[model samples]
Target: MNRWLARLLDTRVPALPLALFRIGFSVVMIIEIEQMYRFRRLLFDPMPYVIESTIPSGPLLLIWLAAVLFLLAGYRTRLAAVVHYVMAVIVLGFGALPHGEDWQGDSLILTLSLLLLFMPSDRVLSVERLMERRRRAREKVKDPGPVDVRLIHTVFLYLTIGLMYLDSAFFKLSSPMYLSGLGVWAPSTLPINAYHNVSWLMSQEWLVRPLGYALLAFESLFLFLYPVRRLRLPLLAVGALFHLGVMFVFPIPVISLLVLALYLGLVPAGAYERFTRLWRARAVSLTVYYDRLCPLCRQTVAVLDALDLRGAVAWKPLQDHAAEEPQLAAIPEEELLHDIYAVDRQGRIHKGVDTYAAVLRTSGWLAPLGWLLGVWPVHPVAQRIYGAVAEKRAREGGCRDGVCSLARPGAPAAEPAPHRGPGRLARPAAGVLLTAWLLSFVLIVPAGPLLRTYVTGDGALANRLENTAEYYKSRVYPWTGWTSHGVFMDEHFVNYRVQTMLVFEREGREPLRLPTIRPDGYTGSYNSGRLWELWTFETVKPELPLDQVERNMSRFVTYWAVRNGIPLEEGRILILQRPMDVTLDRFRRDRLADNLSQPWKEVGAITGSPGQLKVSFTGEPGNQSGLYGPRS
Candidate 1:
């Protein structure tokens, strides 16, 4: 047992998987932030209450963006992680409360950021690692070999993710909707979830039923299969496919990509290394020849060598290896000295800008940049830029008489060195924290159900446990309930589409419905799905209190008018419910078009100007005064 514990706790593992996870996580976050920034006025500014006290939303977003960028670059990573986490909590967590903008994906992001605090994710493939390598070289320190992180950190990450899926699966299994195989089909039918018109596909019982069961199985068994060494890679591949499908089918791109990013942490060290090795073996080979005696040439080569992680480029100094290489011997010595050259495996020579582009193409993650530089319009501009730089270097007499002060191209200074692993206390601390976290998953998270089953006496102990469980469920794990309860497991699926219309009550003209909320086509439907949800579900729903809905509608109308340049002085906002009975029978009969052509029913309306808007419900008899209030 002691040996097993030691192996689990102290063993060193490759940090590549964690590094990849960090990069992927950062990329998804960058995209999410950009999206939020694009819609900041709608998302942050129009909230009924103040979002932040000290920092305004705009500046806060900018600061959060800078922190995320630093985290992405892996510079001052620990500090960046902390700053980003605090900013996320402030902006996304609490700030969303007033506007009912809290998303379950934000919870996952918060959890991941917390996990990042404990991870040594910057140990490899980071700017910090590169800087440390340079520092060691400058100080003449010996290389400490390949970078590796503690096995405990990797275990912590995997267990946290596993428990999340397992927790979700536990609740899903209990849900009648999932057991009846209506889990996937129900959500696909809703306009709020589906990106495209997938009602026809959802109507196919043969396809959806199996997909529903498969999703349940994947979520339920992922925790078990992911830990098995041999099954890890295949499980991750399956997960990738699952998330990719979700991305195409739904508008929840942020959540889908975030979940996919987490899968990177599950990749085994050996498997990742093997995959990279295979990629490098199959990649096109190229040899780059540069002037070693020239300071500028050597500097440029050093940077490229660092980026060439797969060693696809053979960097040979023309001053030293030209005589030995037949390919170099074919080219004029004067031409070789004047400009950089790349000889591919086919023995075709590329010069100047093309040579740089060729080198970039061989480097992993830099291939897109290489393609951009070599493409039409860009290639010509790049050639001119390269020529100007090359001309200046030649005029200055690069390395006069074979004398240069810079280190050689492939010197010890340029080679990567292993970074320091986590501190001695880090392992024990992480182990304790992770153990407690897993215990919360098993004990605290489901405490309510467990206590209710076993402790039926209703004593003091039972009461305390019940209170604690309720607190955890309501406060600590509020966002998690959405994941646990099968998504779209509502008692009744929506049979009507909620449409918000901006009506202008002009004297000479009929009530004009502005195109603000009306989606144009499939793309518009996909983009404005969130807007519909905000106005329909959160703002103007009949279930909401009349006063609250009125306030929300006022803000909504004001923002809508300002954003779309619509005059709201003599206008009223209408919340119409359009019948959309997308049943399996209708789908089979090819009568889905009948549902779309149905006339709109005005369920609610907000009349008068922006600030003085009065909300009134015209739906069912009792809905006029709202469900929570007495009828007037």
Candidate 2:
């Protein structure tokens, strides 16, 4: 029992997966932050429905941006992780309250950032690692060749992911739409959610029904099987393809990207190494020779080494190899010391700024940078800058004494020592903390469902269980709300589509529609989809009173009018429901040409000025307005 516990808690795996995860996570976050910044006004501005002020200040977003950038560079990684996580909770969690833009993807990002705070992601593939390596080289510390992370770190990450899948699968299994094999098809009809029209493909029962079942099976089995070492790689591959499909088909790019980032954590260290080795083998190779005795040159080379992720560039000291290497024999030692040189596979030497470009070209991601530097207009300027820097370094660098000693290659001084992890007491404490965390996670994730399922009758025990379930639902579920993975998992999703239309009745002009319906779709540019989400929540749920919905719609229209410089002294905000049954019936009968010819039914309408609008409901649950045809 002790042996098994030790293996589970103390065994170390390669740190590459965590490092890669940090990179992907940071990149996705930066993209998400950019989008938030773009829509800051709409997201942070006050709204009629939001009773309390949840506005996140503009400077907070800038701070969040800085934190993510620092996290990406791996400088003070733990501190950056903390800052980013806090900022996400404030800016993404609370700030999105007014616009109702907060999503499960945001929660997932928060969870990942929180996990990153405890991870040693800076141990490799970071600016911190480069600095540490250089410091160790200077101090003559024995090199610890590669970094390793505790197995428990990875275990928790995978555990969280598996629980997410399991939670979603359980909900999907209980959903009648999924059972009927119309889970994917139902959501495809929602214009607000879809990016491209795939109704024809989704309507094909033979293709979509099996796909629905396969998706359900995949999610259901993932929790149990993904942790198996032999099955992990295959599952990860399928997961990637699945996310890619989601990204292409849906407008929720942020969600798909975050999920894909999480997939990086499941990659095995050995597999990552093997794939990188294969990539490096196929890449072009170059050898860079620099002045070793010159501190500036050595520092520059160290930075390049950090950037050389593909391992395509080999660095050698010109002082040590000038005499032995035939390629360098032709160039004078004075010229070699004056500027850096790179020899390509064809034995052609590139000098000064050109050498930098050649070396950069061998790097996978930096190749575009190399091409840019070598372009017609930029090349001359780069050459001039390189020449001036090289001249200054050659004159006053550390080599001025002409007798500076250099450490031999492969010596202790040339490599960094392995990182010493937590102390003896701390390690055991970490183990205990991790165990407790896993236990709590396992217990809390399904607490609501379990409580609701077993506890029954109106006794004290049942009341307690009901309270516990409600507590979990209102509090804990927000953080772990991956249960709604089956998009449009209800019958109403197939029955009708929700749309909000804005009309501006100007004094001297005809009424203008805020989003003019085009042949392609709704063409409003400013946060139109977010508004659709908001209106859908209001109309479908019917929890909010008609007056509150009207007030909110009035405020939204006024905000849009102000932004677009439109005079909206009087107008009507119409929340319409378009029946989908007729279209689905047509689609089923192979009459695809006029599938979208169904007329809209007004569910509710708010008329008058923004301040004194009157609200009324027509096609509500009890009221009949042809919303569901003869069934109503």
TM-score of each: 0.79, 0.82
Worst 10 residues of 2 by lDDT: 584-593
Per-residue accuracy of model 2 over 143-200 as CA lDDT, tens digit each: 3668888786787678667767776776676666676665665555555445666666
Tell me model 1's lDDT, rounded to 2 decimals.
Answer: 0.65
lDDT of 1 by residue, 104-135 (tens): 56667877887788788998888888776555
Q: In terms of TM-score, how similar is model 1 to the real structure?
A: 0.79
Q: Model 2 Cα RMSD, Å?
A: 5.2
Query: Against the unseen true structure, what C-alpha lDDT does each candidate score?
Result: 0.65, 0.64
Which pairs of residues collide in model 1?
none
Instruction: Provide backbone clash counts, one per model.
Output: 0, 3
List CA RMSD, all candidates. Answer: 5.5, 5.2
